[model samples]
Target: MTLEAYNLLGWKSETVNLSFPDEDSWRLDAILYEVDSQKSFYWLLFTGGSISIYLLIYFIQKDSLLKAIRKSRLLFTILFPILLIYIDVNRIEELIHLSL
Candidate 1:
C-alpha cells in the first residue's frame, strides 16, 4: 500500500528495499553515540525507543515495514534537533558545575 502510495505520489522509488535494524540494533546504535549530556541521552534513548515502538506498531498494521517506518519517521525527525539542544544545555550545566 505504501509503495503504491509512493508511486501515486510520484515520488522516486528506490529499487533496493532498505531496512531498519531491530530494537536491539537500534539500542546498539544508541550506545555507539552515547554522550554524557542529558539531552544527547534523551535523544538517543527517545529516538531509539520511538523507532522500536514504531516498528511494533508497524507490525500490527500488517502493512509493509517500510510503510510503517515512513509514518513513524516523523517522530525522530521532529525530535532530533530538540535532542541536540537538550544535550547542549546539559553540557553547559556540567561545565558550570565543574567550574563552581
Candidate 2:
C-alpha cells in the first residue's frame, strides 16, 4: 500500500538504491493553498511520490518501518490541528482546504 511496502517487495529506483537511510531524514513538504483541481495533481503526485519513495527506500532497509510511519502520522495528527487554529486565528490563506 506504501512505497516502503513496495521496497520490501523489491522495487527500487536507480538513483538512490543505497541512499535510503539518508533520504529517510526527509518527508513530504510544500507551500500550501486551496488548490483547484489542476494544482491538486502536483500536490498529490509530489507529496504522495515523496512519501512513497521515501518510505520505499527507507523502510525496506530499516528494521523499524512501521514505527517510523506511525510516529510521522501521529506527529502530523497532533500538529495539524494547532496549525489550523493558527490559520483560523490569523485568517491565513494558506492551506484553507485542509480546514474544510
- 1-100, model 2: which lDDT tens digit per residue? 0212124356764331122234432321221232233244445445655665566556657657677665345445435444544444343233222322
- The per-model lDDT (C-alpha) reads 0.52, 0.41
Q: Using Cα atoms with residue i matched to residue i, what is each candidate's TM-score against the true structure?
A: 0.30, 0.26
For model 1, give the 10-residue run with minimal summed lDDT.
1-10
Clashing pairs in 2: 3-56, 4-55, 4-56
Candidate 1 local Cα displacement, residue 36, angstroms: 14
Model 1, span 1-100: residue lDDT tens: 0111125477975432223346435433342244345446556766776666867596648877676666566556556656775666555445333333
